[model samples]
Target: MDEDDVSVLVASLLRGDRRALARLITLVENRPRLRDRIMSLIYPYTGNAYVIGITGSPGSGKSTLVDKLTGELRTRGKTVGIIAIDPTSPFTGGAILGDRIRMLSKSTDEGVFIRSMSTRGSLGGLSRAAYDAIALLDAFGKDFVIVETVGTGQAEVDIVDAAYTSIVVVTPDMGDEIQAIKAGILEIADIFVVNKADLENVEATVMALQMMLDLSDKGDWRPPIIKTVATKGVGIKELLDAIERHRAYICETDRIEKMHYKRSKVRILEIVRSKLMDKLIRELENSGELDRIVKCVVEKKMDPYSAADEILRKLDKK
Candidate 1:
């Protein structure tokens, strides 16, 4: 779509045109021109939405928690947007889950908008399209945007940094896994949720998490662990309370500066890495070096590590 089309869509979105909002998200997610144009058009109305990121291990009931929390938000007269970040097909770069099956119940609700995105090989968690998708939801006037990510803790934590408040979901039986994952996942959590509370070892699970957090020394923002049986909707209130408490803390001391710094540094590296990789690949293609390296490895004349070092040497030259 063109700039005029984007203008119409943005105007429609502000006027509460739901169809226009969907079209705008599609436009933004696919076309860069439309993405930039639509974002600029809706810039005035942006930042009103609280972007909440929910992430965890594969079986941690993140989807269920999001479903329940969003339902509660809707009942409280708030609108919600969901971005379910699943893996992309290696061949197609499209999401494995074409739609969020768990979030589909909200489709009929005019107050809820759910969009799906692929991690799209953007290993830092979330695709290039995700930023646009979030912007679209923010512009569409959703009071809250909840991003649910795929994969285990690390991948989830990376994406949730963009959120105003991040909830790290875990289950009662994740003791060993939690210890292994603690280093990466603990740092990003604004609120830590131990879902599946009805399962065995609930108290032990909470104690383990708290003990780990205490050992990590993440300063004064001690992450509160809330236990929940998400299926039964138990402990959802405490989860929301923890979110509010963190939000208030962020505003009072204003980590907006720190958040901005963290975000910018990550983004700069993403851009630099993309450019560097692109340059390396092009150099390989031009040098006929990639084919030769494969040939050398097939003949057992050189290993993969040496081939990579040679490639780096070639690229480092002017």
Candidate 2:
């Protein structure tokens, strides 16, 4: 699409056009060249929506929790946007399981918009375009945007940077409370959710988490632990209430501003790094320097680091 088309689509998105919103997200994801313009248009309308990030181990029931939360949010007269990060498809490099399939109930609900994104080999359990997708959802006038990360266990901590409220879900049957501490998941949680509370050894799991929280210096706002059976819609209301309390606490104490500022800094640096690498690689490839360096590395004539430095030196000269 051209500049005029992008502007029109963004206008429609601001006016609550769901199709327009989906198209804009697609454009940003598949066509990286257009991402900056799209985000620049969408940024001003954001900050009105509350963003929540949910992440955990593979079988922690995060998707179910997110679905229940969306329903609860809707009953209270709120519009919801869901960004579910699924594993990348090997064939198409796109999301294999669509949001409609996972969230069949909310598919027809006009108040809720669900979009499943492929990880596309991006680490930290998020799609590379996830931040931009959140902005689009916010600009589309959603009151709440929930980002459910790909279940990559320990390395999923990046969600903290993308969300005002980050929830780390854990199951009782997962075993070994020490694993949580080791994973560094404890550090990022604004709320700790012990889902599947119906399972045995639930108390032990809860106790372990409580003990860990007591030991850690969590600053002024201590993260609360809420137990839930997400599949049966149990304890979901309490979870939502905890989320609200955290939100109010951050807003009243003016910590939300600091969080937003930190997120903005990380995002700007990420964009700059990615763009520079892309441009430098393109330049090297066109000039055959990249091929020469790879050949030398493969033949063990030069180390990878030295080859990389040589490339940078050449670029600096240009």
Candidate 3:
């Protein structure tokens, strides 16, 4: 029924209907429809807006940095879309980190649209709803979309992969920060930033980052580390310029092709996994086979892998 509703919903979105946009995202996030079919219908209108992903450890001033950037972008006359992803509280199943403060604190700015999102049970610590939100913003014709993640752990790495230019925010006295840099964020960093530059040990933090960058032996496209006290708006423009330079390079070389190809593969896998899992569960319940499979796997009578294979085989018919 939701799949039947999707085409009309998406068409209404294209006509600037906010309700349709909200409903479409809800359907996708809930997997309440033939989501892949709906997504395919909407695909051509996506990918026009720039996605800037800001991620870093907690207490790294990520929210502050994003707030400052929002001001600068508005000053430049861009219609901005902000999606601040806060971790959902497991007990309440709601966003507990209070993201709207940074977004809504910018009163009197009508050109900007600010919305806070919860991770909504995504183990990756991002949201399955995030992609749909981005698409809605893009279709709404925003010049730029800023996605700020609650940078807790490995999920910080996933944020950059979704962004056109990944920015890793850092601060002084972070113990595990250096190790996280190597795990993949360094490789994804189109630009690195050491926030809270006025703090003590600022230079030491910069040096430590430089040492790590040196160890990477990255090619000609070395990601520069910019220092910023975002609350004071220091060094924001330079960081923006660095992002521009990287954008130029990505445009000039084969990076666009490769990036899109990789994005396509990732999107395909995500769509398939979401759609197929939903379909399998529904079909199994309808046939009363889910309990049988669960019993087989739980009783030590069947391995989990074999049980999964059996389900996939059955779902293949649908």
Candidate 4:
């Protein structure tokens, strides 16, 4: 599509055309050249939606929970946008669980927009395009935006930086899964959900999470542990209430302002780092400097660190 077409589509999106919004997301995801322009156009319109990040191990019922939450939000007259990040196929670069076959019920709802994104081999358990996608959804005027990250272990805590509220879901009989939680996931959660609560040992799982929470010092806010059966929609209302309460607490205590400042600082640094790397690589490739450095390193004429330093020096000169 040309510039005129893109502008028309952006206008349509701002007018609440879901199809136009989908097309704009696709354009931003596939075309790097259009991302900055599109984000610049939409930046001012964002920050209105409440962003929620949900993450857990595979088969922890995150999709079902999100589906139920969307229903609850819609009943309250709120529009929703969901971004489910699925693992990417190493060979195909497509989502292994793309389209979330189980969420068909919400697909036709005009007020709810669902998108499935491949992690695309990003080790952070989020797609690089996830931030841009959230911005688009917020700018499109969704009252709530939920980002369900790739099923992750303890190390993939990037969601904490991306969302206003971060929920970590676990299940009964987790056995070793509890250790994974304690390793790093515990520090990032603002709420914990013991999903599949009907199963045996549910109390033990809840107890374990509560015990961990007790040991931590979160100032005036304590992360609530809610029991839920996503498949049956049991305790969903309570879960929603917990989310709202946390949001209210954060607002009352001014934690929201601190989060906004942190997010802005992190995002700007990320953009600068990415842009500098791209510029340096392109310049080196075009000038044959990259090949020369590679040859020198291969022939033992210069060490890798020295080669990198030479590149940086050249970059500084330019």
Lowest-sum lDDT 10-residue window in model 1: 92-101
Best by lDDT: 2
| Candidate 4 C-alpha lDDT tens digits along 245-315 | 98998898778899999989988988787788888899889999899999999999999999999988887
Candidate numbers sorted by TM-score from highest down: 4, 2, 3, 1
**Candidate 2 worst ten-residue window by lDDT:** 92-101
Alpha carbon lDDT of each predicted model = 0.80, 0.84, 0.77, 0.83
Which regions of candidate 4 fall more than 4 Å away from where they truly are? Answer: 91-95, 99-101, 121-125, 153-156
Q: Candidate 3: misplaced stretches above 4 Å?
A: 1-27, 34-42, 91-95, 123-125, 312-318
Which candidate number has the best TM-score? Answer: 4
Best-to-worst ranking by lDDT: 2, 4, 1, 3
Whole-model alpha-carbon lDDT for candidate 1: 0.80
Q: What is the per-residue lDDT of model 2 for residues 133-199, given as tens digits with 9 covering 90 to 100?
A: 9989988999999988755653367777788899999889978844645348778899999999999
lDDT winner between candidates 1 and 3 = 1
| Per-residue lDDT of 58 in model 4 | 76
Tens digits of per-residue lDDT for model 1, 89-163:
677444347435554467688899887776765756677677667777887788999999865534576776578
Q: So what's the TM-score on candidate 3?
A: 0.86
